[model samples]
Target: MKHLTYFIIFFSSINLFGQVNYSGFIDKYPIELSADINTSGNSYGVYVYTAYDDPIVLEGNLQKGKLIFFEKNSKGNKSASMTFEKFNLDSESIEGIWKDLKNGKELKITLSKKNEIGDGIIQKTSIGDRYFRIVADDQNVSEIKIFQKKTDKLIQKLKVDCQFRGVHCISTGDYNFDGITDFSIFESSYAGPNTSSLYFLYNPKTKKYFESGFSGTSLEFDAKRKRIIETNQCCAGSSVTTAEYKVIKNKMILEKERCFKWSEKKQELIERKVSECR
Candidate 1:
């Protein structure tokens, strides 16, 4: 019925244990599924309808090019089963049959490997002059392609190591405060608000983006002030660090830093250390 252009990945033990994310439709209804099969053919993951966002437990096995799996309800009762007659996790797309174990009705199942980060959503900006694309593979790897919009010519392609797939997995900005916009890909995240990204700064001379070794924890860019700020928390949020940097020739130079310790008595952050570049 309702076609959804975006979907969220439900992280569980399956995702943590390295499952491949997939997106497609089951009888014209958008669905997202994450699954992986072990060497012994044991399959596991979660399936969800984009409209409802309810996760159904999935478990089954792969046998002789056929993947047979069942969806279990919240009550642990088997609701339906699916058989991918020519199951190949590496295939671009898959077609199969879904059987309702209770009602004996059938529905056509079609699925394709999904990219957690890119979905052709960011194509109308200044860079839209080029057809930009980000494709993620089964190995948590992504390839970025920039093509000439008018001639459909490919400009550049880069390999990147990344994880997850969704809106939060990609971002664009001018990290170096340059007039041209740059982009970044999410790498990983730690506890609290601490996270990291791989930045690709725009290069005017080369007409391409180059991966800058610039990295920090929870980075924030201040275009007006021309400064980069990094916020980090540790020790169960009892300690905090804030570092300020200035972009010098595309490299971040540390300018000043301050450390704070959580005060248990006053229930506030107490400044512990302050330093500046010598």
Candidate 2:
């Protein structure tokens, strides 16, 4: 197992004159905008967000405090475009006129500095002598970092690129019977209605948290039994599988597995033992 650290700074400050970095909602629209202007280079990177779709990135140039950008859909066609005119950062509220090129509509746009925790959320937990922080963005967990509580020396950081809804983010508990707390984050599958999770178990001997090979959808950590029970629906409610695991020599070993399937004639669930482990 490997422990790695990754860092990404989502915010930037205005250094050069006429350059602005603003993140806020578009006035009267259900959309969010994060714009970065580089007056020195005459370039900008803008990100537009909506609830149902992923964030769209647009690149363009700025001239005389006016920023223009365009976005393309997944099919490589021009989906929409925006033009921000009179982008003034000196006012108490950053206001401008946003022109929608595709719809031929112009809107009043107001922007503000984004809150630190608005886009990304952070939580702290402990495992034995180590303290860890979990950071999550809108789409998925961005990173997991471990550090010493006393010295504040960072031990490791792992950058995760998993897509998950923001509702059920991450959890921490002692699941491996190592007297150290472990962490878990759910990763949803893109193709189907299934979700798999990632577990990081703490190693007391090495003073590091290693990624467990175990993965499942619904995970229940049994501290008393020192086991992890996972259940997932198979074949669109026709069958389901449940597996139990225990930590043995710093590894998750499957102890037992049972599957249940719908019996058409009997109108009941038929039980069968399964030997597969995931």
Candidate 3:
């Protein structure tokens, strides 16, 4: 009897150390799962959420087929040890056993596979009830598609010409305060220090993203102040010109202008205000 008990305990210890293969699962499946860790105290808390549901707060570590952790409530005061069992991953779904520690309630949870856009990095934003997915392939954005989350209907498709290597070159926000999300792409000149930017403004009347006539180098949008700023360098960076514009009636109206030039006598930069908006 003593030898049999030792063998049972040894087998259980081997099963407890099994780990979930996160990288292999994400690569083979078209799903995204985000885990946020908060290490405010000695015990680290984790919040797990899929693209479909709200985050579930749990203070636990995974061991084999068990999630050994504490479940935290919304108030952050109450916690109980929650052990999830039967955690299994297959080709189409992730099956697990979810248990509520406080009340000793258990439920089976299965996460099904969902389709994603392109293989590139996906940047998502919402305008009202509609959501837009922007997929970028390295330096170039190959596709931009807008769809309704409820019905999965493709509303609009836009092909952009701007190409930049960095992810910061593309952004989406309500630049014009029109209650619609707009997109901007910044493209840098390959041979020069100059940059060119393009804007796609969302038109509610037409229900589409229309290309605005506004184009500039070194373009930036001040979302908090609702202003557009542009800067241009001339004479090989010897002189710099800056302009501020406000969007009015789908037009960028210049509001202020300033210029900076290198002073040969002072061996420094000098600033001057321009009276003309251009």
Q: Which candidate is the best by lDDT?
A: 1
Q: Per-residue alpha-carbon lDDT of model 2 for 1-278, expressed as tens digits?
A: 12112121232322334323355555665444444455464443444333322345565666787767666666776666666676555644466555565677776666775445432322222444454444655445777666554454678887776653332345677767777677876655522234567787777678677888776666788888889887666555556677798878767788888776666776555665454312
Model 1 residue 55 lDDT score: 45
User: Residue 94 of candidate 3: its Cα lDDT?
Assistant: 59
For model 3, give the 10-residue run with minimal summed lDDT.
1-10
Q: What value does the lDDT take at residue 244 in candidate 3? A: 96
lDDT of 3 by residue, 1-278 (tens): 01111011111111122112221122233233322122221122222222332223444555555445566676885455534365343334555544566777665444553334352222323455555444554346666666654455778887775563322344677767676788766554522355676778987788788778887766778878889888776665556677899999988999987777666776555675554223
Model 3: residues with Cα > 4 Å off, grouped in runs: 1-30, 33-121, 124-129, 135-138, 164-169, 189-194, 223-226, 234-236, 272-278
The CA lDDT at 195 in model 3 is 68
Ranking by TM-score: 1, 3, 2
TM-score of each: 0.55, 0.48, 0.51
Clashing residue pairs in candidate 2 (N, C-alpha, C atoms within 3 angstroms): 4-157, 5-157
Give me the candidate number with maximum TM-score: 1
Q: Could you tell me the lDDT of residue 91 within candidate 1?
A: 85
Q: What does the lDDT come to for candidate 2?
A: 0.57
**What's the number of clashes in each of the models?**
2, 2, 1
Give the local distance difference test score of model 1: 0.70
Error of 3 at 5 (Å): 79
